[model samples]
Target: MTDVFAGVRLLGPPETDGEYIALSEHETVHLHEYTRIYAVPGLYEHVVQERLRCTSPQVAAAGFLRAAATLGLEPDSMTVLDVGAGTGLVGELVRHGGVGRVVGVDALAAARAASLRDRPGVYAGYVVGDFLHADELREALRPYALGGLVSAGAFGGTHATPQALRNALAVLSSGAPVAFTIDERWMDASDPDGFGAAVEQLVADGRLDVLERTRFQHRVTTTGEPVFYQLVVGRTG
Candidate 1:
């Protein structure tokens, strides 16, 4: 698999609309073909984490820990919810940061299966359902009394919607720390449906209080092109 992955070359520009990777001596696949990627163990880690040099998992975990500290919350006293918890990388990081328990949520069942297979016991529970529309999801998660919400590389594009984010926040305890990363471009207030504008609405409505927001390289494309994202750390009102 290493050799197979090593032979891959990412197609240009890392455009959000579409991206491709030509596998060395193998085949090309759409970058977002998560179902295929997650099916094979270590493939996602090799491609996205090691090959692409993605940094969102580390950034999100660190940001969440710092935010939790700022809010005077003890990790052992709370259970954190990880949105778009792909393969449990962020969940493992948060756990290593002393978080007593972490729960993972993703729309794809493959993601849940991969997480359990690749990184066992990292998440106290992993929910496979739509964050916005799954009636069973919210009720299933409500029992945990989620204290913090954290995500990595899960927003923007066709991923989690702002409405989904709102629903997650509603389940959190007031003042629970929120940490996530999204493409910097999506944070723009100019795009009404974008996270940037959505965040403004959240702030204005007193639903969120941002503490730290910074831009950092999320990862590089197969062509060594840098992709940046905004690490947003805040607390719910």
Candidate 2:
């Protein structure tokens, strides 16, 4: 197979993400450039998965299974929701992990398109709407009986907020398995409105019961520097 990354160049370190690939010799894009990145077929997979060696997808999928096992629950009848659902990478992983059904939710329509193009049939259904405030989105997802939630590289930074997490949990069945990964910097920050505080508040309020929290290298930066993120496993109250 030919190397797709051969045409790409490293621009430098991204602020928080572990990727920093250039479109051309002189044109670099931030990770937030989703439209540009997702527009190109195989670009995201090559840059983020192959080149950067991202592992959050696998980690989050495995974490979900671990959470289920810890809860003495089986996946035979569970339906999982993959938040972010970019290109269906995480969704595909969870599906192969034995989750009977996996629905995807992403705010970007382009993401949904890319997933269909690159990884068709991975998601039982893909919904594009805001998890935080889309009133109609809740109804749209209700048919899936969202009993489990899993995500990787879809929280923190310019991605899903902690409130989004809460809103998602609100619709899930009680004691639904939940697993996700967030950058360590975002997970440890003391900002009152940050994920750290939000999660603390969730656990304190008995909304989310955390089961396991561990840190690992999510991926490597353009300069080959390790970037760490925390995998959080829990269940809704």
Candidate 3:
């Protein structure tokens, strides 16, 4: 059987740092353009997962599960807040990992719509609001008593900013597990985004405790070059 997105074409290389393409009957868009991509069922998976082989969701979930296990936390008893939960991919994986409840947060309505269409019932609750400024969402999530935060492939580029991470942490209970994956370059000292510095300062200030850090292939670029990402699992202090 022919794939739904078999006609989609991606162009660009790892050096470009992002992929761009015009799918059949669609406008040209970048690979990280979640709103547009999610509007079309199977397109995001075909481009990012099937073609590029992105495994960030699995990597982040594995690290979180392992950390939770080491901390004597039962996955089936934990409620996790999935930041930047594009199309509910990470939420689905985390839920399957036995998390009792999964809440998804993203800035795009298209993402929420897509998640409902593609992975219905995966997230106990899905919020369509920016993590940085969505006070209502923060309040809505309060009822969930989130015990952990998990984000995959949503920290770098035009996705969630460092401040978004802080906002996400604010909603979780103290000492909750936090896990995420980002391009290694985002953590470089030279990167102007200051994500690395922000995280380091959080640790230095005793606000977060580092548990595990692993580097792995996040995916391959359209040019077939490997893109490396770092998975970080920690606990809010």
Candidate 4:
């Protein structure tokens, strides 16, 4: 817990009995490995923003705002849906940007608990279930009439798949705006991972606009290496 906005410094992951832990750090900490980090209230911030200098939440929110401005739509009029919402950090930013209502969907119950613990009143409703698995998720979302979907730093991971993205989008109104960011490696054509194909299809078929995309310093790795990611803002037209 240090001055996060000021700078990023390297700090190795928690150790027990001088044993080495196998944890990979990209801009912030790894999402999948949340158990060790989330045990401490602010340790996630310390490792992600302070030590690793991850700016994904901020960048993702900014990208959504930029797209809103371009479309001449006020953020306050939009009903926001945060897919893969981790602890409601990105939702907080979106709400601050004037989004009328915000709902968060996360696979882990820990995410919902952490969001309520860390940032209450940020999300109108927080659901604990995988979008791909839970049937109640769709029913719960029906009342929101979501106008925009903002998912930052939470795509193509083990929790989120192309099928899940398709399901999430299926719940939205037609041409709903969607903005998200992911590591650029996911965009590589040579990669056997299906992410490249999914993203390409989503963009090509007017399922995603892909308006603004830029490579920026997402955060530093645990080994003190800079991690770059592509932040994309777009409409789902």
- Candidate 3 local lDDT, 33-82, one digit each (tens): 77878888777877787788999989998888887988889989988988
List lDDT for all candidates, in order: 0.88, 0.86, 0.83, 0.75
Model 1: pairs clashing at backbone N, Cα or C within 3 Å: 187-196
lDDT of 2 by residue, 10-124 (tens): 6676465645667887788875688889998988888888878899999999999999989988887788999889898888887787888899999999999999999998888
lDDT per residue for candidate 1 within 1-237, as digits (tens), equals 677666667776455546777755577788889998888788888888887899999999999999999988899888999999989999999998999999999999999999999999999999988767846788888778789999997878789888888887888888999999999878888999899998889899999999999999999876787999999999999
lDDT of 1: 0.88
> Which one is best on TM-score?
1
Give lDDT tens digits, candidate 4, residues 136-205: 7898787787888888877765557767776777777766667788877776756655566777788788
Candidate 4: deviation at residue 237, Å?
2.2
Error of 4 at 180 (Å): 0.3
User: What TM-score, over all chains together, does every model reach?
Assistant: 0.93, 0.92, 0.92, 0.83
Using lDDT as the measure, which candidate wins? 1
* Model 4, position 57: C-alpha lDDT score: 90
lDDT for position 40 in model 4: 51
| Residues forming the 10-long window of minimal summed lDDT in candidate 4 | 17-26
